[model samples]
Target: MSNSKLYKGSINTIILKLLNEHNKMYGYEITQKVKDLTKGELNITEGALYPALHKLEAEGLLDVEIAKVDNRLRKYYKLTENGTKETANKLEELADYIKTMQTLINPKLA
Candidate 1:
């Protein structure tokens, strides 16, 4: 599958989990971090990422802080308390999804 196609459904959960682990991250930093963490298996484009970030922020699951970093304004995103709880739920859901898919894809193995 194409990188975007493969990860479309899981991006939000990945982003949330990353923020849960790191506390806070900016947009580019988040993308780069995901690339690093996944060993390039997932490549998140700006077109896809910023919208999700904005949506999450709008939904009150995220808090943004604007700060100067090396003379450039950067918006950092951190999960709110509600976001943390939501992330936990989302992670569990993702785990279950993976298990289900695995079973469906290789029922003989199971």
Candidate 2:
């Protein structure tokens, strides 16, 4: 039973939440932050990350800016106005989902 399957569904929310907290972040930075926060239990792949970013950007929930650092162009992401609203909505939704899952996993805790 891999935890990846469990986390896959929530990746978007995770990304949005991180951006909300940090103001802005690059893709690799996002991946590393998650891994560090999870104590290496979770690893976010570029394959899963970039496509999600693209989708979010396309949906107008995210804004991208390019900066040249160390002579290389790096793309950074930040939440747009809509994204900030969406982040709040997603976080509330996630809290509900987690509560439901917790009740299912342990009725005594409910």
Candidate 3:
């Protein structure tokens, strides 16, 4: 993200939401997809992304698949059952956060 601090807290939620929508994705693919979806307004870096992935895996919110493509192994991530549920909850929380922030920023938006 261009303004990563503002977005850092939502990285896991973002990852889960994207995995929910796309089913499965590799690390670089996830980065590219986020970039494309946000029109480059957000950029997920390796420093930020992998640790989040590992954390989700440790939390049992994600599953990893390893596949060989032309002698190179690639790691793909997908949402687990718990992850699906979490995604919905996180999205709702994010939406509510946006609404609250909007209200605070501009009471007319409330």
lDDT value for candidate 2?
A: 0.93
Model 1 poorest 10 in a row by lDDT:
1-10
Model 1 CA lDDT for position 22: 95
Native-to-model Cα distance after best TM-score fit, residue 62 in candidate 1, in Å: 0.3
Report the C-alpha lDDT of model 3 over 37-91, residue by residue, as the tens digit: 9999999988899999999999999999999987999999999999999999999
Q: Cα deviation of 40 in candidate 2 (Å)?
A: 0.2
> If scored against the real structure, what TM-score would every candidate get?
0.93, 0.95, 0.95
Q: What's the distance in Å from true for residue 93, model 1?
A: 0.7
CA-lDDT, candidates in order: 0.89, 0.93, 0.93
Across 16-101, the per-residue lDDT of candidate 2 in tens digits comes to 99999999899999999998999989888888999999999999999999999999999999999999999999999999999999
Candidate 3 residue pairs in backbone clash:
1-43
lDDT (tens digit, per residue) of candidate 1 on 5-108: 75888878888999999999999998899888889887898988999999999999999999998998989999999999999999999989888988999998
